[model samples]
Target chain A: MAAGSGRAVVGRQGAPLWLRKLGSMFLNVYAMAGFLYLLLPVFVIVLFSFNEPGITRDGVFRPAVRGVRNYRWGRFSIDAWKDPFKLPDLTNAFQTSLKIAALTTVIAVAIGTLMAIALVKYDFRGKGPISTFLILPLTMPEVVMGLSLLVLFVSWGIPRGFLTILIAHVMFSVSYVATTVKARLRGFEWRLEEAAADLGASPQRTFFKVTLPLITPGIFAAALLTFALSLDDFVITYLNRGPQVTTFPVQIWLTKKSGVPVQINVFATLVLIVSVSIALLGLYVQRRRERPVAD
Target chain B: MSNARSTKRWAPWALLGPGVVWLVVFFAFPLVRLLTTALDDSETTRRLGGGGIKNFTTIPKNYGEVLVRTFTYSLIATLLCIAIGYPMAYFIAMRGGRFKNALLALVVLPFFTTYLIRTIAWRVIVDQEGPLVGFLRWTGMIGDSEGLLGRPISVVFALVYNFLPFMVLPIYVSLEKIDKRLLEAGRDLFASAPRTFRKVTMRLSLPGVFAGSLLTFIPASGDFVNADLLGTDSTLMIGNIIEKNFLKEQFRPGISALSFVLMLLILGGVLLYAKLLGTEDLI
Candidate 1:
């Protein structure tokens, strides 16, 4: 009886052990493939960045395992790093991007926060429609939105220029800010404001002291997101920007169309590092907020 | 003292005022103006108005091919992104632990670069001399590099790469919202892993799946960036065509028609997505 029971146990365990091994292997393979898919383009760019003569037999940039000579050469040449500046046009574009990004962030965040507060904190007429209307740009294609703005600007005799591009960016970015801020406010407790009112503090003073302080982080987050989004904007800016008002992205577009340049890769890597750092830092903060406090 | 109530009453408006003014100036006005210009165009009126669909009929005749190609590539690229992105999202959601943040970060990191810069990166990498060609040759994957680019594959790859995060993020959000307890309950009820996933996980993840699909499909369908960056003349996207007419002073009426149709198509897709996810799932 003991031997028979032992044999039964062994038989049952053997199949699962083998199956488990196979399952784990399959998962590992899948995970590896996904990692590769995520990293492939980045890896390709980084690898090509270091590959030099950097030119192929066809006089075009190609990847070769030819070592670190290209990196050394590019690093040694300060002018190569300053190529965007040398274009004069490129420097103007960069400054234009900065100014537009700054303006768009301020305008979009302020409006979005107010709308979010109103919609989330108080009952109002036509709130649903208001929300939907705000969300309209989020769903519309960049091309459609860009073209729509272009037509509007031209028809109004507004003249396509920096101001138009800035407005268009703020329009698109405002919705995103409002959505996120409203989401953050959903977790807010209104009883604090009620308590302040009950304790003889006026609503205006209470809100200025309490409400703004609590939501400031969310406001900041929205601002950062809007700024990043505005900085990288291309479609609307491209459509609405006047001949003399090219932004960094527009300049890059023209340059790429002319032919590929290595400096763009260097610029891209820098942009990637900065933007990703900001996004990941935000995610980290969110994660920390979600964790349970230990006694 | 009474100013408190007055301030309280007007505070929300004060908050909402700047945003509303911005939108009215930038968004609403622009759209209104665009429609009027198109409708009022003498050329568009001359071509299509006299007994036809008016301004609308003129668009198709002028930009039919551009419209068709744009939708074709967008639809194709969107489908491919879903096919590629879904499995990847699933793997990350289910299997990721300590590595989840890192992996998600990788997905979003590339998007930080300007669109033009990333597209230019591909231009460098996919060129005749770029590493992709070199790697393919080294690995015996292709006999030559000439056929690899200026083709739909390169454009599709760029689109997929650029938009993959949009697809993944929405689905990841949806997937994370799924109730883990229900998953455990399925297991406790003696359901097999695959069966539980099929019955529970898949059903609940539909909203996220739909959101991701819409996010990817809308932009991908309308995108001309990849086509412009990676394609030859034969592969112009709808966006490129519309852009040509709008900016480069070519095929004016045709571009307008194509733009109008593409907008409708986009609206249709958004409505469909809303229907699938219900209106509340809209992000």
Candidate 2:
């Protein structure tokens, strides 16, 4: 107990720092290793994109040679980069994924923003239940949601194609959009609208000029998130996708049998680049917004 | 005045209408449909009302192994995520003074790539002749007969790898919110560092832990991709079984039954967890 008090005095004076330093150092190493683990697959994907086309042996293009796996960086080749669209249906699938994602984002953001507004700005009957119900889709597994939707479509005699995929995407994406927008709305003050109203702005005019501008960042973030979710969705898309429609993820899944083309890496790399750029841009904007307040 | 008051009362409903209706039709309706279909016997008819309670009862009798494996794998994966994620989250929260946002971004950046592609990259990394395998072989850890692929370890590793960010983010959020002054107070009280961490830090971070574990465990349980890509036939999860029943075997009723069971189990686990953590409002 005496020793402990002595150490506490040293700690209070902020001089007994070795333990804290040692702890932080250890934490830094662990954090670095964790980050490396997260990035290892990404590095492998990008690195192997430059690998030479697998050689065909006995009418089969083997990805790796004997005693060496296909993961190795063999001879560097620019063939994949030169013709990333080598696969026949790759572009079609990419386009389909983009269309679905865009449509889903727009529709989800429209409905979700309104729902978020309602949940935040108004007190109403069934509000608690509605909030809980909205979160249900997020908690449920993708496979269950997909299978159930498939059943619904099949039973309703609705042809399972782009339409069904769109419906399913919107279904899942709304919850996300609403959640994101609601988070943003939580920090918002409704009196801004009231102030605008008192300043002679019409209800619609206040919303468009004042409220919408304030919440635009959240809406934008939500839309981007929804797009990413829709684009990368596999399990649900796989189950709901009709025989005719194939999204990029479904195409990639199918390619597992035929051997994943190097072009898929190229596509994935592009997606990574686009998403990172958007995120960095968002960070920059947020920093800029916070700077004035800090000052 | 009365007319305006009524409009104000209905306004929230009007705002919530489209999104709620869409969810009801696409989300809630499908769940109800799934329950009905699961209870029905598809062998007799494609429509509902033939199987009764047999579908639910047959789950434990028939696919019990798959159900157990799914939870087991998910549980193991969630624990692994916590082990790997907690330290990293702690480091960023406590020590990442100026670069906290940048560090957090680094954690999330890898998720920009498609999840499937990332999992596939694991296949390459753990390939028979891959570097990881080579290293293991060099250390004489794995025999020539023992490979990383087609093993339970690889599947769980893939799951931990993929869903780690989900675990880290929530924990980071909770940990970062913890006031540093509380730690200082504990220190000022002459509490040892480990004791302070346990009593103050860990206790305060329970909500994040609960959220992170749920996020990691739920999806990991439902995921078939890791098991399909990394594991052998022996490691097939309930997800694989459901997928097979739906897509391959074309057994709709059976798939529905399995899916219903899986959903119930997850929902029950989540409710129980939420109750224990007293974090119903956190979600």
- What is the TM-score of each predicted model, taking all chains together? 0.85, 0.93
lDDT of 2 by residue, A1-295 (tens): 2444466556663435677657667888988999999989999888777777455567766555333233445556777889988777887999999999999999999999999999999988899999999998989889999999988888898988999999999999999999999999997989999999999999999999999999998999899999999999999999998889999999888878657777888899999989989998888888898886753
- Residue A262 displacement (Å), model 2: 0.1
For residues A146-246, write the lDDT of model 1, one tens digit per residue.
Answer: 88777766666888888888778888998999998998899799889888889999979998988999999889889988988988888878888998898
Q: What's the DockQ for every one of the candidates?
A: 0.46, 0.62
- Runs of candidate 1 with Cα error greater than 4 angstroms are A1-24, A44-79, A82-84, A202-204, A277-295, B1-14, B41-54, B58-62, B134-145, B248-253, B273-283
B76 in model 1: Cα distance from truth in Å? 2.6
lDDT of 1 by residue, B1-283 (tens): 6997677677666667777777777777766665555555565346544222455765566557767777777777677777777767777776677788777877776667677666656665677655678788888887864546788888888887788788888777778788888877775565655677789988887787777777787888778788987898988888887666687432444354556678887888677667765654445
For model 1, what is the alpha-carbon lDDT of residue B255?
A: 51
TM-score of 1: 0.85
Q: Largest lDDT belongs to which candidate?
A: 2
Q: Clash pairs of candidate 1?
A: A62-B129, A62-B130, A63-B130, A63-B131
Say what the RMSD of model 1 is.
5.5
Native interface contact recovery, model 2: 0.70
How does residue A50 of candidate 1 score in lDDT? 39
